[model samples]
Target chain A: AQSVAQPEDQVNVAEGNPLTVKCTYSVSGNPYLFWYVQYPNRGLQFLLKYITGDNLVKGSYGFEAEFNKSQTSFHLKKPSALVSDSALYFCAVKEGGNNRKLIWGLGTSLAVNP
Target chain B: EPEVTQTPSHQVTQMGQEVILRCVPISNHLYFYWYRQILGQKVEFLVSFYNNEISEKSEIFDDQFSVERPDGSNFTLKIRSTKLEDSAMYFCASSGRTSGNTIYFGEGSWLTVV
Candidate 1:
């Protein structure tokens, strides 16, 4: 089975400061991890994904995530935060192959304050 | 960038009424999926379709739920008889090939059962 855990229900950050939303996963084989953001009343927007190659994967809107195999973690990070970046963040994982479906985490609410 | 699109941004129906939610996936994508998020809950997978057939589905996708690719460009999810608990935001997603690919999500259709 594959699953992801977003330990924090909410994360607060000040504008211009770095932000981190933790995510950890469990999978039978190699994991394909993803980060998506959802603004109010909108659908989830893909942020980034970790498939293979480098440990650090950069994505849209200046966000990135580090895939740590040892820790079974794929934590989303932003070098600097913006008030507009505040949204609901979700972490999802899949055991790569014909699975076709992702195991999702309970979203973490991010609030960036100016 | 092309995107997946969903119809009926919002809908309200009485309990036990049948509801059909529609989606048009990215033209070039080969895999399609449906997921739902009840308020404050995780985004749960409903089903995945490829080659006009369901490749996978979650436990939440019970007998009450059925999916159809009625045409080359459209995918629909039908709820046989909606319950109050079925109220949720339904998201349609599509990917280029497999689970490892980055999937794009539609804005979602919000369903309210009375």
Candidate 2:
């Protein structure tokens, strides 16, 4: 079955340090990958998505993700972490074509300490 | 920027009672979706609505669940009889005319069943 995996349950980083949240996906066709973030008591917020073009896709809040087809990975990354970035991050994917439902990864809790 | 909107940011109900969650998708979006996240769990798709009908649904979207676009602006999800297991954060989302567009989500409605 098509699925997404966020291998890390939690990632910790010092403020201003680079941070990464790993994600890998398996699907039958071209994958449309996405990243979302949820702050406590708030709804999931769209971060970035990879549809076709450049492997490096930039999103809201200084976040970006690299889509690596060979590795079947689309990892979320930020050049510099902020305490405000501490939250739960999710990776989701849907196969290209008419598929409407998104296969989601168990979220990764990111804590950027000051 | 336009965004989806949901009502009753939080609701508490007794088991076996019916509950309706309301949403207002982005004005121009043609595709609507409902998803849920059990506390600390991966987001799960429940159903997708398009052209005034359900286009897709997950196994979790059983007979107990129903969706309607009840007019031009409001989309709703009705649970015929709520269960304790139904306690979750229900998100309402929408996308552009085509499936390739990004789905934007609303601040979810939290349902607490007792």
Candidate 3:
């Protein structure tokens, strides 16, 4: 079975400062990694994904992630934090072999201070 | 842009009551999925449907749960009998069913089993 881990329960950063939400995973064969953001009372919105490609993948809302296979990590990063970016972020992984299942991590709450 | 949509933003039901959550996936997507998130917990995959049949399911999706694409557009999750533990936000998602594809999510339906 595949699994994802989001070590932080919450992260705080000042507006205009860069921010990072870390994610790691364990799966068989290759891994399909993804990032998502959620606002209160809403569902998750896709941020980015890492398939078989270059290590670095860019995503929506000015965010990007680097797939480090050796580290088993796909961390979400933003150049600059915004007050509006405060929300819950989740990391997910799907089996890259023959399994068609997705495993998710407990979301990390992000707070951007003004 | 096209996205998955779930109805009944909130549904409150008594224990042992049957509830069917409805969803309409993206028009062009071929794979549909159901997931649930308990308060302060990780989002758990319930089931995955494709070609009008279940492609995959998790432990959480057992005899008590069933999914159906009753029509061309609507997909539904039926809970045979509700329990207090079932109270959570249920989200519907859809994807293009390609390798390493991205999945779009619905706003989610908050189900509270009293």
Candidate 4:
């Protein structure tokens, strides 16, 4: 079994400031974690993924997420936020082994203010 | 960049009518999946296909829903009879690796059952 939880429905951050979108997961085995962003009326775009090795993975548009094992978390982060970075973000997980189903988060709408 | 492309960006159908959503995944990908997102809801996994058969599916992928690799280049999702609750955005995704791989998504096909 696998699942993802994004506790926040929305997160607000000032432009040029740092931002974080929290994500937690539940999986019976090693988890393949991922982050994706969706703009209005657009399909989701892959941000980054954590398969193994490095705990910190860098992704598109200067986005990054850290894989924290003890906490069962993979939090998306950006050193400096931009107004254009505001969008709906989702966290997804696929349990290792033969589990092919990718469980997704409810999503978090990020708003960046200037 | 190569991408997963979906057809009929938007479709409107009456309740009880059948609807087929189409997608063309990246040329070399071997794994295919379908997911849906109702307006203001989390993205839900519907089904995943590999090796010419279904690899996994969620409870939401009832008998009313069917998927096929009808031809060489296209994958399709067919809903036997759409209901009001069926109105949502459908996404198609694909991945190349067999395990713990990153899946790329299409822009999506919006289905509105009236």
Candidate 5:
């Protein structure tokens, strides 16, 4: 079984400030974690993924996420936020092995203000 | 860069009517999937298709739901009879090999069941 949780419904950050959107997951086996962003009236765009190896994975548009095994978390971060970065973000997990279906979080709305 | 494309960006159908949502995945991708996001809800996986057959499906993919790669370029999801609760944004995604690989999603088709 696999599940992902994004506890925050929304997160606000000032432009040019660091921002973080939290994500936690539970999987019976190793997990393939991913982050995706969705702009208004647009489809989900892949941000980055954590399959193995490095705990810190860099992704598109200067965004990155750290996989913390001890905490069972994968949090998306950006050193400097931009107003254009504001969008709905989702965390997804696919349990290792043959489970090809992705279990997604409820999503968090990020609002970067200038 | 190649991308997954979906048709009927928006569709409205009456209850009990059958509807087919279509997608054209990236040309080189092999695995295809369908997911739906109801308003204010998390994205839920429906099914995964490969080699002209369903590889895996979630509980949400019932007898009323069916998927097929009707031709070389198109993948389709058919709902036998839509209910009001069936209204949602359906996303089509594709991946090259494994669940660990990056999956690209289409812009999604909005189905409004009336």
Candidate 6:
């Protein structure tokens, strides 16, 4: 079945350090991948998406993700972490077609310490 | 920028009571969707509505669940009889005319069943 996997349950980074939240997906067709962030008590907020373009896609809040087709991965990254960036991150995927539903990954909680 | 909006940011109800969650999708969007996430769990698709009808729904969207675009502006999800397992954060989302367009989500309604 089509699915998304966020391997890390939690990631910790000191302020100003680079951070990474890993994601991998398996789908039958071209995959539309997305990243969403959720602050405590808030809903999912779109961060970035990779449809068909350059491998590097930048999103809101200085976040970027690299879509690696060969590895079946779309890992989220940030050059510098902020305490404010500490939150739950989710990776979702949808097959390219008439399917409108998204397959979600178990969220990864990131904690950026000052 | 326009964004989806949902009402009753939080609601608590006894099991077996009926609950309706209301949403106002972005004015220009053509597709609307409902999804839910139990505390500390991955997001799950509930149903999708388009052109005044339900286009898709997951197994979780059983007979107890129903969706309606009552008018031009409001989309609603009604639970015929709530259960303790129904406690979740319900998100309302919308997208442009095409399936590839990014789906923007609302702040979500937290439904607590006791």
TM-score of chain A of each: 0.98, 0.99, 0.96, 0.98, 0.98, 0.99
Consecutive 10-residue window with the lowest summed lDDT within model 4 chain A:
A94-103
Candidate 1, A1-114: lDDT as tens digits: 678999999999999999999999999999999999999999999999999999999999999999999999999999999999999999999888767788899999999999
What docking grade applies to model 4?
Answer: high
DockQ preference between candidates 1 and 2, better one: 1
Q: After superposition, how far is residue B58 of candidate 2 from its true place, in Å?
A: 0.7
**Model 2: DockQ against the native?**
0.84
DockQ of each: 0.89, 0.84, 0.78, 0.88, 0.90, 0.89
Comparing 3 with 6 on lDDT, the higher-scoring candidate is 6
Per-residue lDDT over B1-114 for candidate 5, one digit per residue giving the tens place of the 0 to 100 score:
899999999999999999999999999899999999999999999999988899999899999999989889999999999999999999999998766789999999999999
The alpha-carbon lDDT assigned to residue A60 of candidate 5 equals: 99
Q: Write the per-residue lDDT of candidate 3 for residues B1-114, one digit (tens) a residue.
A: 998999889999999999999999999999899999998888999999988899989899989999999999999999999999999999999988685789899999999999
Q: Give the TM-score of candidate 5.
A: 0.98
> In order of the candidates, what TM-score does chain B achieve?
0.97, 0.98, 0.98, 0.97, 0.97, 0.99
Q: Select the stronger candidate by lDDT from 2 and 6.
A: 6
Which lDDT tens digits does candidate 2 get at residues A1-114? 999999999999999999999999999999999999999988888999999999999999999999999999999999999999999999999999989899899999999999
Report the Cα lDDT for residue B29, model 6: 96
DockQ of 1: 0.89
Off by over 4 Å in 1: none
Candidate 2 C-alpha error for residue B50, in Å: 0.2
Residue A99 CA error for candidate 5 (Å)? 1.7
Indicate which candidate wins on DockQ: 5
Q: Which residue pairs come into collision in candidate 6?
A: none
The runs of at least 3 residues in candidate 2 whose Cα sits more than 4 Å from the true structure, single-residue gaps closed, are none
lDDT of 2 by residue, B48-76 (tens): 99999999999999999999998999999
